[model samples]
Target: MTTNTLDADLALRLAVEDLYADYVHTIDDDRLEEWPGLFTEDGIYRVTTRENHDNGLPLAMVYCDGRGMMADRISALRTANIYEPHVYCHVLSAVRILGASGGVIRARSNFSVLRTMQEGDTSLFAVGRTFDTLVEEGGRLRFRERLAVLDSRRVDTLLVIPV
Candidate 1:
């Protein structure tokens, strides 16, 4: 690759990694209101089993279309949903840029989230890979689409928070 190409790739990598870091911090810190701002106005967010995603199944454990729907999720969590308050520690790795097409960048990243209850008990909450399509919107990188494909289909407890 030319020097320009290499530099561009490095810049992209850093920007995407920063986005992931910010996203993780938002959810982990329980700043739910800020989560939707990470995405575009008409973004899509979905969490599903790897098998289902691979098979092209439309079934989703948690799915939201548009920032409004995402905001609704936060509202429900804060108001309607009743669950123990917990915090997540996310470990993300293997962030790879798949390609860029039509002003959107495609990427994938592996993530493992550990959930800690208010009682201080911790456990592996979720292991998944996120596939994302990103675009620059209003001078910042925003997720146009984000799909979290969990390795296991069975969730042991209530999934009140996004992974």
Candidate 2:
């Protein structure tokens, strides 16, 4: 690879990493309102099992077709959904930049979410791979699509929050 190509790749990877970090903090800090802003207006988000994703199944744990839908989810979680109030601590690593073309970037990363309850109980909530397509909009990387495929199919309890 050329020097300029290497520099561009590094810059893109760092931007994507920052986006992921922002996403984690937004949710973990209970700043749900900011969640949808991370995505494009017509972005898609889905969480499913690895098996289901690999098999091309339409099933998903949580699916949102647009930023509007994502916003609704946050609203529902805040006002309608009744579950244990908990926080997630996300650990993201192994970020792989698959490719970039026509201003779109494809990437993948592994994530582990640690959930903590009000009573101080903590557990490994989820482990998954995040497959993402990002676009540069207003000089910021915004998610065009994000699919989180969980390694395990069984969830301990209700998944009120998005993974």
Candidate 3:
């Protein structure tokens, strides 16, 4: 590719990179309402086991389509969700665009989630890849779909945010 083409891809990649980073921040800060704003009105969010995906079984820990569903998630989290005493720190790496269709750009990235409790304990809660579809809208990129394929099942506590 020419330098211009490369630069274009890089720019787009960086934008998505920052979005991924901001996503981690939003989840960590418990800004759940703002979390859904990162996505499009018809966006999708899901977290599933790699085993289930590989086996072609449709099972997921969190699955939502559209901002309304995402809103409901936030409501449930704030008003109804409960979990063990711990905080999750998520780190994302190796973000790259895998493909695209129309305005949608599909991407993948590796992620590691670290957990800490009030008892002065810490450990790796889960590690996996985040598969996402982004679209450029109103001169900005937004998530149209995101699938956090966690490698670890039998989670210790509740997963209330996107990984």
Candidate 4:
């Protein structure tokens, strides 16, 4: 490949990696309100089980169709939703940039989240893979769509926080 092409690829990879880091940190730090800003105005977010994903089912445990919806969910989580006070530590790996075209990038990454409650008990909260469609907006990569496919169907508690 040409030097310019290689440079572009490297830059793209770095940008995507940064986005992933920012995403996890935002959630893990309990800065839920900032989470939605990482997406485009019309971005979509969904969390579903692997079985449902494999079966092409449309059901999702958490579904937000736009940035507005995402913000609303956060609002509900902050003001309306009732659940145990917990924090998530997200470990992300295997971030692969599948393809890029038309200023959009397709990527996937593996993630595992450990949850710690206010009582200091910690446990594996969720293990999943994220399929993301990202676009550059205002000079930064933003998620156009993010779908988290959990490996297991069981959730022991109310999933108030974004995975």
How many clashes does each candidate structure show, in the order listed?
0, 0, 0, 0
Residue 28 in candidate 4, Cα distance off native in Å:
0.7
Steric clash count of candidate 4:
0
Between candidates 2 and 3, the one scoring higher on TM-score is 2
Off by over 4 Å in 2: none
Model 4 lDDT on a 0 to 1 scale:
0.96
TM-score of each: 0.96, 0.96, 0.91, 0.98
lDDT over C-alpha atoms for residue 36 of model 1: 98
lDDT of 4 at 108: 99
lDDT of 2 by residue, 1-163 (tens): 9999899888888898999989899988888899999999999999999889889898998999999999999999999989988989999899888999999999999999999998999999999999999999988999999999999988888788787
Ranking by TM-score, best first? 4, 1, 2, 3
What digit string (tens of lDDT, one per residue) describes model 4 on residues 55-119? 99999999999999999999998999888899999999999999999998999999999999999
- Point to the candidate with the largest TM-score: 4
Task: Show model 3 residue runs off by greater than 4 Å.
Answer: none
lDDT of each: 0.93, 0.92, 0.84, 0.96
Distance from true location, Cα of 14 in model 1, Å: 1.0
Least accurate 10 contiguous residues by lDDT in model 3: 154-163
Q: How close is candidate 4 to the true structure, as a TM-score?
A: 0.98
Per-residue lDDT of model 3, residues 38-115, tens digit only = 998999899999899889989888899889999998898778878655677887789888976687788999999988
